[model samples]
Target: MSTPVDTPAPATTGAAPAALDVLHRVFGYDAFRGQQAAIIDQVVQGGDALVLMPTGGGKSLCYQVPALVRSGIGVVVSPLIALMQDQVDALAANGVRAEFLNSTQGPDERRRVEQAVLAGQVDMLYLAPERLKLESTRALLDRATVSLFAIDEAHCVAQWGHDFRPDYLELSVLHERWPTIPRIALTATATPQTHREISARLGLDDAAHFVADFDRPNIQYRIEPKAAALQQLLKFIRTEHAGDAGIVYCLSRNSVERTAAALADQGIAALPYHAGLDAGIRARNQSRFLREDGIVMVATIAFGMGIDKPDVRFVAHLDLPKSVEGYYQETGRAGRDGLPSTAWLAYGLNDVVQQRRMIDQSDGDAAHRRQLSAHLDAMLALCETIECRRVRLLAYFGQEFAPGGRESTACGNCDTCIAPPEAWDGTVPAQKLLSTIVRLEREHRQRYGAGHLVDILVGKRSPRVAELGHDALSTFGIGADLGEQEWRAVVRQLLAQGFVAVAGDGYGTLVLSPTSADVLGGRTSVRMRREPIRASRPARATRRAAAQPDMPTEAVPLFEALRVWRSTQAKERSVPAYVVFSDATLRGIAATRPDSIEQLAEVSGVGAAKLETYGELVLEVVAAAA
Candidate 1:
């Protein structure tokens, strides 16, 4: 039986006219994105809200502007200390009275912040959920007047979310403690079910719910099946975006270190960032990535939540993310400045097995595991799909893309659009593979991994296949028409489409999913791509020419000068220059020839510290060049 869906109630009230004036005065913007104005208005009017906006969709302003305009302090509950510090730093740089209470602070410092809160001096106080459990913290919260309680990363409250925390489950007590205070729960990534879980867990029964579209129009999405993934990653980085600020995400800490080292060896300025690194080093590396340009931060998923860097040109995944929501959030870190960016991912059958094994090992409830598996299946389908990757991605998030419309462009700059491959009929091969699975009694027995199965079918008398006597089976040698690479591709596509599953044991054997019966029953047809031969390397001159931008001849020298200056500054500071000023920022400065510290400060990366440190030297260089 289908369960009835509950309808959302209308917002409790409207925002005050005074708040609108404050928003313009502080934020320097006239309006909000999507439902931001309405959400902010509701929050300002002392009504609870649950906001689910995509990354780079102005989730912060929904709470920030209201917190500034509202009467009392806005208490923001965040999960990560680094994220809280980043947000607080950015807000303080904008002249907002923001502070954070987390493990980083001493008791005396915490007491000072509490005193400031009690004195109504802080407009916003960011707290880690763990900090809320302290006796002193609860006592302060009991007495202090809070205009609104904001939960950032609200999806963490849901068990089905990729980054769930148990402390978030206790947040519902906020409503019981401070019944009159308005609560605003905000997250950049959450599915429809996750949204419901968050709303329920936060005790936001009468909250105004706002779900902005999850599609990131500026990001070009591409998925490549795993074969020489590292080489492909290097080619993409070197050929398309030689020196752009980007991130490379891995599924493991070891992979992060290895990939970072490999990129550095190839003359790329890369750094490893994971929980294993010391806190100081991680902070420095993160700051360098945020402040510098053209730095490739190879990190696990720990690196990019709440990162406000706007011009990250690319995001590459060395492994598949846990779910589509996680993938979207991680990829959304790029192209945030409304500029062109790329989201490239590489996956294989091994990734599927490992991910499935992870799900089986997790201690989540059955419903949560089922939901996660469904989400992962959707992600795998996206990876294997020959259709527009952006369309499938949006559909997973319950959003629709325009058919054959400009909105479907996906930047007109993805691998599939640029160089789509021809498809071949694979009905017979698929049937053989499915039949093999059943013939081996592999349905519940020891399922074979793709390599072993392909070896058996293609008549490669490997030691393992010989031992199993699978060469004597009727399905054996029937797939000889397909090469090893081609068979591997088919197996990957099948696994991705949920037509098969992988065993949770060490052997990582592949078993059939429920959908396999349809294929065996001749109810489905498969069309697969033939593996393309690797192309010769481009000529050196041609590669350099491709890397060069088509700037005006007069501007070229200035750009070079800026780059040289940036290189020197970066070397002296032991940081990447994009950390000093992005290429876009450099272009802006070179074009405008900002004459003073005040003018240079207006540049994106020329924050107060940078301006104070390098202002004079930059001005001298600019004046000399002019």
Candidate 2:
């Protein structure tokens, strides 16, 4: 006989509820992978946070769950209108009440969304920072029930960032205006300095900072010397990344067009995307790239911010990025779904020279120029370093990547580990270069840039050297034993080693740092990598052999089928296919061959709403494939 007892109902409110409920029931994940659960709890409890997560690190969930579980609306400030729309659509697809307000909408549309906000019908509201600065928009938000504020791409707030937004400077007003609302600022890539700047500028200085590891181990980092870059790119695509969705980033609009045309000539389905293109064309190309498979986007940096495409197998750089942050952010756009991806760059001495020249020629104040030079110098070190690229990159962000064993120290995924360059004792040439700069500074009371100084060292009778009387210096012509290339290498190493610095304004004059005295005084010896000779085609074949494709060949058909299904669903809903299900989700579905709705539910990213909406179709497809 069962005893009759009073049963208590489940308790709610006050104490933290199960975030895993939202994770599994809403987003279809079994659990929080890393710091996600902690981050979600912090925000839900009305605390502020500054999350420095890597790209595709499930950053959305940190705010999304709290937005749903907490009382009122989650206001998200994004820089791009398209990104706002895409994020909202994706949330809606996951059965979250998400809406966006942007310039693309008409008055009637805006009014409808505003009305929904007033009526408490929206869970998340995404707006551009510019829109948030409007008085009328402020009034509307003040009247509504606000839960929390999420600032996406928070690194844009840094004045020194490559993608600086003046509008982002005004975002701190959110905290002042809504003092009670918890705020979270998030970004994909930020160096230590950039991280500090973001927190201060966005008024998140008091927020709890959660920095995830910046290393993308699945990404194979390759830096090849530039010799006929177009041919090298073509060979890479044909041999290594055939039929894969990828981004080819160029430094200029003209290069974007030329690369796109060249890829097309080689029978690859390529599209050009740059600021110079007509707005309509750019939109259409971006849409096609998002919707279609086996399409390569040849673009500039303008094309990749807030791009949520997950199946990008590669991000190849035709030219150098301005900073490690830019390179990290740009390359991060690829393999976001945690699949193996390629980050390939073709760089040379010219790339270094050109990047320096651009910074010098820019019409900024001396301080601004110095800041830009500092950023570029870090990038150059990454390019020229023979150390593990992953180690160097993560170290820049203040994270140590000691992988336990000495064997683990070598990442085994970068060019350095595969084919390391011979390290030569650069002590002799380094001293020569440092002495030349010191001589110029002490004797002439003048500073010269790398180009002029290199001319002086290599015994070139250049006009600048002759006029400056640099040819008569003792250090002059002493380095003539090393050719111009070798001299440039030494100067680059000196700048990198902190033995020399770029000083003064307007095209930067070389100045000796305090550390230069050590090298000049024979207290320090610098060893630099002898740049490897350009590889022949057969040699490239050996490197290619070490690479592996992201997906298995057997899974190709099902992957295509899943893409088609996603595309169809996206079109029916008038949203992007990724809004329906990310490429990562579809790939998971294809690989697992989930034969039943129950099995499908067990897959990551298969939230309850998605299972209810597309379960039967997914099951049928899997069954037919079987």
lDDT of each: 0.77, 0.82
- Show where candidate 1 strays beyond 4 Å: 1-25, 403-413, 421-424, 438-447, 466-469, 513-517, 527-626
TM-score of each: 0.83, 0.83
Query: Candidate 2's C-alpha lDDT?
Result: 0.82
* Candidate No. with top lDDT: 2
Tens-place lDDT digits, model 2, residues 26-88 = 998776756777678778888898888899898888888888888999999999785676777
Residue-level error in angstroms, candidate 2, position 534 = 8.7
Q: Which stretches of candidate 2 lie over 4 Å from their true place?
A: 1-17, 404-408, 427-526, 532-557, 571-574
Write the residue-wise lDDT of candidate 1 on 260-363 in tens digits.
99999999999999999999999888877865668999999988887777778899999998888899999999977666678989887788878888887778
Candidate 2, RMSD to the unseen true structure: 7.4
